[model samples]
Target chain A: MSPVSTSASRLVYDALKSCGVRLMSALPETWLVHLIGLAEADPDMTLVRLAKEEEGVGISAGAHLAGVKSAMLMQNHGFLASINGIVSCAQLYRIPLLMLVSYRGEFGERDPWQTEGGGVTEDLLRALRIPFARLENPSHVSHRIAKAQTLAHSANKPVALLLCRDLMWEEQT
Target chain B: MRRLDALRAVYSQLEGRIVVTIMGAVAAELQSIGHRPNFFYLQHAMGLASSLGLGIALSRPDRQVVVFDGDGSVLMNLGGLTTLARYRPRNLVHVVFDNESLLSVGGFPTATSTGSDLAGIAAAAGVPRTQTVRSIDEFTHAFDEALAAEDLTTLVAKVEPVGPSAYVTDLSLLENRFQFQRYLKESRTTR
Candidate 1:
């Protein structure tokens, strides 16, 4: 039997396309690996992998300024590194920046390092004052993604869509 | 003519436009000269300036966006040209400062040494209008004309090799960041 498609990925892709997102700056991580694949498969979307998390934010900010809709995909840990770019460039310029973040340590995650990032992910975003949504079901993905995009666009600010690992991978096993 | 002169010419002609500057000395200069809050300094991203500009332009179609690009940065992601061509933003102006070397990260030769025609490449990549300027006067004319044109345009300015100016104010990374956060907050509350 074929694997069940993750509607989350489709919703994200559609939100990206509908909003005319042309580029995505990302890093390889398990949580967002699927979104990266979808971005690669779509010709309309250009996937830009950065050497560092900070670079991802800067690149996305620049792309957004040049008339391309872009998203910065990274883990919560990486989000810390991107704060400078997000605040200095994106927020300062009133550039719309969408962050697709993975909740690292949620669901009794075994990795110690991941737990550190996961523990502070929500608070970190809160500290940054970037409103976010914890994505639970694929059904709600489209509306939430759209809402985040609208908030970012209208406010020229950054918004996060946090995806917990358990919510996405729990049923697979 | 100085790099600032070329930039000033472009800036003077553009009214209420968002200009995105990539990391490096060029960005600092533009920002120092009173660029709008929409001015994005790529700080460390190197080459993705045009792509970022593309995103902003697409999202806010009502705003005219210009990307101040460096030759080294452009070469790093030449493939981005194809993406730009594909989308073809009408209000997008891609101004490439072709100094023939990576002046920002120490002077290093670029792909242009092997006869990389940046303008030709941009044309092939699908930018509707691609022009090259060798001097400040020429650039000023071209810059003004590009603003008037209603299509995706790429203007390559073969600027003289110059480093960052000495009189510029150096805003710490953290400080600039706070400024931006404040910008978002202020704008949000006002709106």
Candidate 2:
């Protein structure tokens, strides 16, 4: 059998579709340029751009409450800013939402700013009490995205999927 | 009256109430008083606490919802109050602790210290009822009265800046989110 065809962006959008997510709040990150391109092209999808990460969470929560499944996408560093919104609003109001976080700095990564984010990624999630899974490869992206969706909708709580730095930035042409 | 005392009284007296605590010292205080599973603390994000509470109150119209927000946090998203007032969730009770500073990060003064009246802002934004309270007795009485009214209410508690009572850095964020997810699932089955 031929290998499954996918990219990090494809994995995310496909799973979001399967989960019935109607509104997707995102920031303009390099990782999501392609995903945004897809969203911009899709007629059924609604992508809302936020000025800040915290605002994305609030918007997603609002959209979810208004009878639409939603997700918030942001960078790893953005987590610190958005944590309060996640805990206070999403967790408190029991909004079933998914957050897609692009892992910035990981072991063997080159970006100087990302090093700090890669270092504390797990601790941050653990401290915020958000269940998350780190995707290691592009092939497994779809499955992990699906799991994030399942956890979000089934539990009616926020769930995150941390897309590893290499997986998001590496090109596969 | 202390902010803690007022919060404890509110929590104890109110049953089946969904309370959303905003980020800052208020949340830490609420947790220190033997956190009820129903209380959701923002941990670090300020201001948006009321927006979340509005979602809950509107979502579950049958349940009464309360938001314990700090003055600094409220100012961060002051626009939210106007939005909240426009939507008007009748069962929502918003109580702001006006310590006049970013007490949680450090005792830095806020615009409220320089005469920014958030309660007045809330009233001007069309909140049906708004009041300022300085003592515990006042808080309890006002809160009771506010809840009784069939409209969205805002209570500004004139509190002094408080230091963290619990320096707890060990509580699990992942576990909290997971447990809350479980709670929502359970709540659905019950509904």
Candidate 3:
């Protein structure tokens, strides 16, 4: 992990904590490794490591039902994989779900395997009518996350904050 | 044994516990028995009730969370079993009704129809406790024990492939969500 990436991860983690996110569900992915690590180390936060991304949807719903704020951290592919739960469970049940998706396969993509899912990430989010915002600049991280969370709670629907490479990765210098 | 009978045998035991039922037959049948504020019928989303229960269990360790799931739904998200095992919330009781078919959406046979052992799979997934019961007596006993214990337990109840006459419930999805959420909040305050 680059120093800048680790710093960015801390900024995002702090922002989530500030929003009163007590629980988080995630599966191991490159961009989210540090964020997951931070969650694991925090005794105040409960980290539910998921076998698949879709399970996080249900986890977040259950958390909301229990009157606890929670978040989901996953790669863009994970967001795509979780469409069923996002639509049927979160949307149908009117649960506010805050998902921080690691945006891969955009503009400067390395791995060919990621491009397919990344390519369709925005289109699918639009199709689902799931409101989303991009988080690329470090300075905008806290404000963007807080606003996304507020929208999710107010609308009682699934909202996404895409963690772009600019925010998640620092050029290897 | 029939699914309704299995549910009925354990109905009284579910009084104070938070219950989450999967979509379709399980939800419909549970509703037929009677409705409770603590019950959340996860309507459209199949195969994620266990995950939901896990979240509730973890969030409210003071409350017991029980998930009523189906074989088809379980098979749809087998990875959930492993995730449940990973967390191992002591307050969670996962009860899978294996009817060997998707009784809600026509009579399409599921993987369990051939020879998939859900209990065996759950044990392999590292859930603290697991059991498979074929008779109502066995199911009731296992359920009672699971509720009594503080370990995460997965009970697979084998039942006949039969469902209620209708799958519709009078409760809307949003209504159920609010009712359940309100129940959780009130329960917390009273405690």
- In the order shown, what is each candidate's alpha-carbon RMSD? 7.4, 8.0, 1.1
lDDT of 1 by residue, A87-148 (tens): 76666656678888877788768677777777788888899889899877777777888889
Instruction: List ranges where model 2 is wrong by over 4 Å.
Output: A1-56, A59-68, A71-173
Best by TM-score: 3
The candidates' DockQ values read 0.18, 0.12, 0.87
Query: Could you give candidate 1's per-residue lDDT for residues B140-173 as a string of tens digits?
Result: 8888788889688999988777867552456654
CA shift at B191, candidate 1, in angstroms?
Answer: 12
- Model 1: residue B93 alpha-carbon error in angstroms: 0.5
The interface RMSD value for candidate 3 stands at 0.6
Ranking by TM-score: 3, 1, 2
TM-score, first chain, each model: 0.89, 0.88, 0.97
**Span of 10 residues, lowest total lDDT, candidate 2 chain B:** B176-185
Error of 1 at A21 (Å): 10
Docking class of 2: incorrect
Q: Which candidate is the best by DockQ?
A: 3
Worst 10 residues of 2 chain A by lDDT: A1-10
Which residues of candidate 3, in runs, are more than 4 Å off? A1-4
